[model samples]
Target: MSTYLTILGFNSAIPTVKSAPTAQFLEMEERCFLIDCGEGTQVQLRKAKAKFSKINHIFISHLHGDHVFGLPGLISSFRLLGRETPLNVYGPKGIKAMMEAIFKYTETYQGFEVIFHELSSKNSEKIFEDNRVEVYTIPLDHRIYCNGYLFKEKPKERHLNMKEISKYPEIEICDYHNLKRGKDFILKDGYVLKNEVLTTAAEPPVSYAFCSDTRYLESIVPIIKNVDLLYHEATFLHDLKEMAEYTGHTTALEAAKIARKAKAKKLILGHFSNRYADYQVFLNEACEIFPETYLPQQLEPVKI
Candidate 1:
C-alpha cells in the first residue's frame, strides 16, 4: 500500500497572497483524508491534483477560523459536484451546530449525507478505524479545545514466497491465503507443511502524526513517539518564543524539541506565522535540534 502526505496550506491564522491557511491531504492506501479545511482548501486541493470527490472524511483540529473556515465552501462544492456518498466529518463539539447555522442561512441543501462526529476527549483515543488504517486523536494544548490526528497503517498479511510454494504442486492456489495467514498446509498424503517455510514476514506498518496550532506540550510526546512522519506546528521563530506561548502556539525550536523527545523518524515544520517572509529560518532552527527536519512546499507530496 502506498502512503504519502500533501501540504495544501501552511500559514497560521492569517492568509497571505503566497500562502493560504492550515490544510493537508493525507493519502494512504488510495484512500484520501483532509486534515484541516482552511480557507481556499478546495483550490489548493485542485492545485495538488487531489480529487475532491475521493475525499470522504475530513478531520478538523479545532473551531478556529483558519482551521475550518473553508469547510462550508468545500462541502457546498461537493454538493455541486453531485457527490452522493455520505461524508464523515470529525471535529470538536460545536462543529455540527456551526455547519448547521451556515447551511440554514445560506439555504444550502446538501444532496449528500453529512455525518458529524464530535470529539471532546482530553486523552489519546481511537476515533476512526477501517481495514486499511486506524486514526487516533492526539490531545493538544491550545487556547481552545483542540486535537491532532495520528494515521497508522494496519498490519499486513505475510508475503507468500513463490519459490518456496512452487516446490509443492499439491498445494493449490486456494491455500495461498491460508499460508499467508500463517496456517500450515496439509498435503494429500496427510503430511503437513509449516507456514514459515512458505511465506516471509510482511513489512512493518507505517504511521503519520499531524500536530498544529498548539503550544509546546510534552504530554503528547508518548502518543506520537516513533511515528514515520511528524508534522508539528512551528508558528514562530526562536526569537518569538514568548509570543508563541502567549498565543498558544509553538516556536520552531520548541517543535524540534518535541520531535526529538518523541524519537520521530522525520519532523516536518508547518503552520508558520505571517511575520516571517522566509521559511528557511524555521527549517534552519529546527534542523539544529532534529537533523531530520523538513519544510513542505505547497502541493508537493511527501512520501512516507
Candidate 2:
C-alpha cells in the first residue's frame, strides 16, 4: 500500500499568483482525507487530480477565514454533483453552526449527509482510527483554538513466504491468512512449522504530522517525535520572526528547530506569507537547522 500527500495550497492568509491558502490531500490505505479547506481548495483539488468522490473526511485546523472559507463552496458543489455519501467534517467548536448558517442563508441543501465532529480538547488525543490507520490531534498554540492532525498507519500483517509455504502441499489457501497473522502451521504429519520461518516481518508503520497556523510550540514535540514526515508551517522568514510570533505564526527557523528537536525524519515547510517574494529564503533558513527539510509545490504529491 502507498501513502501519498498532495500539496493543494500552502500560502498563509492570502493567495498569491503561485499559491493559495492551507489545504492538503492525504491518501493512505485506499482512503482519502482533506486537511484545512482554505479558499480555492476545491479548484486546487481539481488541479491536483484528486478523487473528490473518495474524500469522505475533512479536517479543519481552525476557524480562520483562510483556513475554512472554501468549505461551503465545496459542500455546495458536492450537492451539485449528486453525491450521496456522507461527508464527515472534523473541526473546532462553531464549525457546524458556521456551515449550517451558510447553507441556510444561501438556501442550499446538500444531497448528501454532512456529519460534523466538533473538537474541544486542549490536549493530544486520538480522534479517528480504523483497522489500517489512526488519526490524532496535535493541540497547537495559536491566537484561536486550533489543532493539527497526526496520521499514522497501523502495523501491517506479515508477508507470507510463498516459497516456504509451497513446500507444504497440505497447506490450503485459507491457511495463508493464519500464517500472516503469525500463527504456527501444523502439518497433517503432526509436524509444527514456526511462524517466523514461514513469513517475513511486516514493514514498520509510517506516521505523518500536519502542523500549521501556530506559533513555535515545544509542548507538541513529544507527541510528534520521530514522525516519518512532518508538514509544519513556516509562515515567514527568520528576519520576520518577531512579526510571526506577534501573529501567532511560526518562522522558518522556528519550524526547523521544532523538527530538529523532535528528531523527525523529514520536514516539509509551508504556509508561506505572500509578503516574501522569494521563497528560497525560507528554505535556506530551515535547511540550516534541519537538512532534511523540503519545500513542496502545489499539485505535487509526495509519497511516503
Candidate 3:
C-alpha cells in the first residue's frame, strides 16, 4: 500500500477562523505518525476521522508554541482514555523537561508510558526505525533549535509471477515466500530457476520530507534530495523575504527553490500567514519554479 499524509492545520503562528497552526498526520505501512501537535489538534484529528489510538509516535520540530502547544491536552486525553501502549515523542533537547513540568502541574501519573527521546544533535541523525520504515532528522535553520523529518519506506518484496511458477510443479505454496524474497528455486534434481524469471521487480521505496518554520537554507537540500513528497513552510511572499529571514521563516518562492534544488517529485507549500487570504497567490509563486506544488487541504489525505 502507498503512504498517505493528512494536513491537520496549516496556518502560521496564529489560529484563524479558516485555519490552525502547523500539524500533520502521516500514515506509512499502517503506522501512524503525528508531526507537530499544534493547538486544537485533537479536534482536528476528530474532524479528520483519524485513528487516534494508532498514533504511537509524535515528532515535534521546535519549541514554538504554535508547533507544540497542543501536546499536553492530547496526552491528557490519552490518559483519560486509558491508553496502555507506550507513546514515543521525539523533539529537541528540552522537550522531556517541558512535558514533565506540564504533567507535574496537572496530573501526576499516567496509565500509559510516555517515552521522550530528546535530541540535541545539530547534524542529521537517524531517530526512528522499524521493519517497514525509517526516519531521519534534517537540521533546520530557525530562530531556535529546530529540525525537519524525513520518512522513508523500506525496500519491498518482489511480486510473485504465478504464471512462471506454474511451469514447475515442484514449486509448492510453501516455497512462494522464498521467491518473493528474490531467492532462486531449486528442484530435487538440482536444476535452478532464476528469481528474475519467477518474480517481477519490486516498486521503488517512497519517501517524504517535512520542513517547518525555517529560513531559506540550502544545506537541507542534500538531506531531502529526490523526496517523493515535500512539505515546506511558506509563511510569506517573495516581496517580504527580508522579513521572513528576520523571523526565521521561508517565503513561497524560496520554498520552491529548495524543492527544485532537492529534485523533489511533489512540493507542498503550507503554514501560510493570515494576512494572505487567497491561497492561489502562493500556488502561483511556487508553480513558477516547481510545477508539482500543492496547497494544503484541511483534513484531506494525499497519497504519496
Question: In model 3, which runs have C-alpha deviations exceeding 4 angstroms?
Answer: none
- Backbone Cα, N, C clashes tallied per candidate: 0, 0, 0
| Candidate 1 Cα outliers beyond 4 Å, as residue runs | 184-196
TM-score of each: 0.96, 0.96, 0.97
Q: lDDT by residue for model 3 over 147-174, one digit each (tens)?
A: 9999999989999999999989999999
Sum up the clashes in candidate 2: 0
Question: Where's the lowest-lDDT run of ten residues in candidate 3?
Answer: 103-112
Q: What is the alpha-carbon lDDT for the whole of candidate 2?
A: 0.93
Write one digit per residue (lDDT tens) for candidate 2, span 136-205. Answer: 9999999999999999999889999999989889888999888888999988789999999999998888
TM-score of 1: 0.96
Question: Whole-model Cα lDDT per candidate?
Answer: 0.93, 0.93, 0.94
Model 2 misses residue 190 by how many Å?
5.3
lDDT of 3: 0.94
Candidate 1 weakest lDDT stretch, 10 residues: 175-184
